[model samples]
Target chain A: MTVQDSLLAPDLPFPIFQISQTVRRYLLYDINTVTWLRRTHNILGVFIGSLPQSPQQNVFFGLPMELQPEEATLLVEKGLAFIADDFRTHKQAVRSPPRAMANYKATARKEALATAKAVTKQKQLKTQEVLQRLNVRQGTPDADNTVDNDEPDESIFDTSTQETSSRPVSSSVIPYSSTPTTSYPPIPTPSKQSSLPLPEVSASSYALFKHLHALGYFMSPGLRFGCQFSVYPGDPLRFHSHFLAMGHDWDEEIDILDLIGGGRLGTGVKKGWLIGGAVKNSDDNEKHVATSEDGQSEIGRKPGDFHVRTFCVEWSGM
Target chain B: MGDLQPSALTAYIEASRPVGVLPQDSHHHALAAQVLHNLQYQHDWTDLRIHTDSSHSARPLLKPLVSGLPPHRIYVHPDEQIEMLKQSVQEKDVPSEREWVLPTHLRETWSLRKFAELFDGIDPVPPAENQASEEKPPFPTAKGGIGSRRGGKRLMLATVGDDSTVVYYVVHDGIVKPRQN
Candidate 1:
């Protein structure tokens, strides 16, 4: 791909993978790839992982560069990079290993305990029936064996019903399989389990990023510059950053000190400070359902493309 | 779940070799690690070298000195700032420049005396861009360009907050003329 091409080279888009949590990594093939990113795009992600630099070993593991979720998500949406599995998709997939493992382990433990309890109770009842049948057979010397088998099954069904009634609703639906739970460790409810449900920082930050990228402004996490994002009016190599952008939500309260601090920093760097939030529409139910998927589609279109309203804050020093 | 990171900042520092023997104190090392991490990633610095040997002077630095070359020049000497200002007035584009970055954390406060000591050890301009930078004074006492850069022996003060927000301020060793608005 021609590096000098004015339009973004669609072919050169990097591949970003969400490794764990806030960390995401991009596998870079060579040192020159880093040099190109550093000098051209102004994409200054850190080298979080590397192999020993030696010529003797033909196996040179590519350098792994790291960026925050805010940075990673933007790179993907802008078509500057494509993620392995979008964070949003991975997040909602209950099958993802980490959370799934924990959830499964706890569920398996609870089911096992309930099954053990029911099995012991059922076995005791079985022994009692067997003993009574033995006594009856001894007394009658010819009680029909088929009738005895039939009688015990009805009683076994009654005992199973009792077990179902006593066990938790989660464990009671399947009747016949007394399958032992796998040897999975017990998992406590995750920290997020009890917290109120809301699309968090990742979602909102992504919303802001999507809005800006659509506007054609290249942006990166403002962490280095003390804001939520830094908006570049043009390719970073050609122009200084134009704005220090901060993102919040409609209902979230912002600190005045933050405004003043952001404004002062903007003034110092000769850039405008932008504070923004995703506009809350009147339809609460639609928004509630769309919150997660809202990031992907623009069909839930409000009056304007700017679902987020950004206002400039420039400090006027007295 | 999104916020948690194995936090490879420390290990990255070790691999980058910002310097060996980071700090005896865990807190100091951690603070140094954070700044170095940001410098490498956020600022796009290369060849980061950390200094923990307090043996540079009497009264060891409150923390370590992190030096690296930012992808772009971050500071302007008084003379260079003046040259750029003059060029801009003359209708010419000011040339791009690069500076060696001295990374610092946000929580640490510094007095003038402390700053002067830091000024003592390092060159006013980083050694990386020596061809264009060598002639410039290591530290100039004159007033700098109009509200552009701080004067005197200056260093880029990179203060990283707990939320990983880093703000850079150009600090001078002593008073200089405040630029006219």
Candidate 2:
């Protein structure tokens, strides 16, 4: 059923707005689409028999003409796309569950709890056995000739301590496996580091900070306190070279602009395929140079002349 | 609810682990925070906060607001749409650019009551002060404008995972006139 169909349906148990509002709530905030699908069967006008395997390329609601089921699936797809595209365009990337993440926590929690209980029981049984062995009386010291209990006592202590230490360590290892493996890796060594050009402003530039702040845009205090930049000295621009690996071509300069502040001008920091604003030398009297090689500026001004700043920043990840 | 806990977001950041903006200064956070970092670094957005609590849960979605100037034309009233349509009847050169919304990652569910609550706390327009640095030249009027002017719309660039799968949205407090798509 298409969203339109559902709106037109006679069998709707709830008010259309109630259902629509519920659907909107799920679309706007639901993290798990599959769970949303299963729980809110009536959210879409038509129900999807099963989720399409390829979500990225799959089209929903392509044509309006179809049976109720097909139309409903398409409508659901449209709703999903509407939400997804809206989110993508606005950059409000909400966390949706990947197929793997779906219901993983619930099952994982169950397994973890089960394993923990079993481990506790196992440990308790082992400790009890040890105690039983230790407390076992060999013929109760009455009738038969008694061997020195101290001799066996020393061996028992050594064996029990060894068993106790080994059991705990092994038990701890089980819990580690129960935790989900992290996706992010730790920081690499310093030698593997490639330097990114830091933006540096002179002590005099501190005055600009106040003006910017008063204007309702603030630099991160960390950036203000410690931001560094590459100085070009007398020349307004500097050229640095690095060898390209694999697909990168030589002489490719990409500029990334600061679109939110600094007059919304491009910063002089561009990586490969990553374009930004070029820092305009306010002092450069030479006919204002355009940012691009072809001299085309998106904003119709020389990119270099758009914003006046002291330094430029650029970096490459690979 | 948001007003009751104005400092909630700040406290969340304080308590959570710090993930550096640059890739090199690696740090650990929950899967959600890492996604939030991608939105911030790539989009140059601010106020990328997420609420992790499970109360009033809706679906698993991230709610974050972008802090910057209005990207393209943010708000289009329904009346304005008609006006633009009439104006375009004569002008042929004007090409409409859909607003570029920044991505944000929110990690909790929200109910209608909560959504209404969030809308209540937010302004009809985006907060001006926390706006991202723009690459475009400031309009002459903006140059002289002083203290806390309209920065633009609230753009939230939210990331769903470790790899960059971002969704952007422009949220409004109440109904506004719709623009011609």
Best by the TM-score measure: 1
Output the TM-score of candidate 1: 0.32
| lDDT for each residue of candidate 1 in A79-107, tens digit (9 for 90 to 100) | 46555433443354444468667776567
Give the per-residue lDDT digits (tens) of candidate 1, residues B3-26: 665557656655554444543455
Docking class of 2: incorrect
Real contacts retained, model 2 = 0.00
Instruction: Identify the leading candidate in terms of lDDT.
Output: 1
Cα shift from native, residue A133, model 2 (Å): 99
Model 1 DockQ (Cα-based): 0.02
Query: Considering only the true interface residues, what is the Cα RMSD of candidate 2 after superposition?
Result: 20.0
The weakest ten consecutive residues by lDDT in model 2 chain A span A241-250
Q: Write the per-residue lDDT of candidate 2 for residues B1-181, one digit (tens) a residue.
A: 3556635433544556544442212222333454455445664444444432222344322233333332134333334445446655322222211222323223423222333334334443332333343323333323322211232222232334334354443332221111223
Candidate 1 Cα misplacement greater than 4 A, ranges: A1-14, A21-63, A74-82, A85-201, A282-306, B1-181
Error of 1 at A68 (Å): 4.0
